[model samples]
Target: QFCVNYKNGGISYRSARDGFGFELDWTEFYTTTRKPSAGEVGALPVSGGVINGNLGIGTPNILGGSSIVLGDNDTGLKQNGDGLLDIYANGVQVFRFQNDTLESKKSINVTGRLTPTDYGNFDSRYVQDIRLGSLQYGQVWNGPGFSDTSGYVITGIINGNSDELIDGAHRRPIQKLIGNQWYNVVSI
Candidate 1:
């Protein structure tokens, strides 16, 4: 037998044979105008919503496996046994994380600045050419000047002395003439 009673601002249901009961709280339900808070236990908003807690999908034990899984169930982010995060695409592991290193199965294209915390090096066997907008020489070139009209070369001074071409510390100012006006290349 089954019974449903309206009480305590909610609908309480009970199964007589199983001796099990549950309550559907009215406060948990919300309309279009009423939205739940970030930490609230309620249905997510149709448009968008913020969750303040950890969300688990596909698995009840979120700590064991991937926290999220796409509709295909193959593409998702998972932490491996080594505690490194791995990114999967179409059931294939495309990217992975090692100790202080990021590994990718394909080529990486960066549009903006790629700054390294310390020193960075590239394999000469794989890297054929590297293009740069401007090249700055640490030491002054005492060799013959190139007559290449394709590129522009500007001569500058360090510490207001043209003879002191090299400034290891880069504490001096570097200036170049631009249409009769001198502009400081590096701010002091």
Candidate 2:
């Protein structure tokens, strides 16, 4: 007969099979491996030990954090396999690593002013947008003013198919800023 004294956090336990009996309380849960004092939580310290599979925090529900960190200024943290690490502040993803390389998948979307002291590098998918009064580089890509129905589209010529120059009226698709690389722009 296993009786639980839930009022005072105690348990009355007995084995019905062999007439053998033993009482196990919440703290007694770890008494077999290590004796824990009254009102103390159990902790296991295993250094240089191997964890086989995925380790999870708040597996199903959301795990909250204030001042969360993955790799700090000091010695960094290491994650080997393809596991996702999400860092959230105020319930928003400030930094995330999902893909293979950390540098490739890592992204920072902060609100306030961010000033980097050292030189920073970005992926090749980034382009500079220069602006002058009513006109700007990459601004013409807006096609017609964006609404819920239509927006700008970037494309490259394929085989000898449909014309690639914004419906092919003004064939001047390539625009060069002085000696820089040509920018394929769509006209208004």
Candidate maximizing lDDT: 1
Clashes found in each candidate (C-alpha, N, C closer than 3 A): 0, 0
Error of 2 at 146 (Å): 46
Off by over 4 Å in 2: 1-43, 48-61, 64-81, 100-188
Candidate 1 residue 13 Cα shift, in angstroms, is 5.5
What is the C-alpha lDDT profile of model 2 across 1-188, one tens digit per residue? 65566575555455444335544332233334354654354333344443444334323222322222323222222233347665544344444466653343345578999875533354223444432222222322324422321222333222234544332211113342332333444445
The candidate that wins on TM-score is: 1
Cα lDDT of model 1 by residue, 76-174, tens digit: 777776768887776677888888788998789999999876442533224333222344433335533334333333344333354545432112234
Instruction: Give candidate 2's TM-score.
Output: 0.22
Candidate 1, backbone clash total: 0
Can you give the TM-score per candidate against the true fold?
Answer: 0.34, 0.22
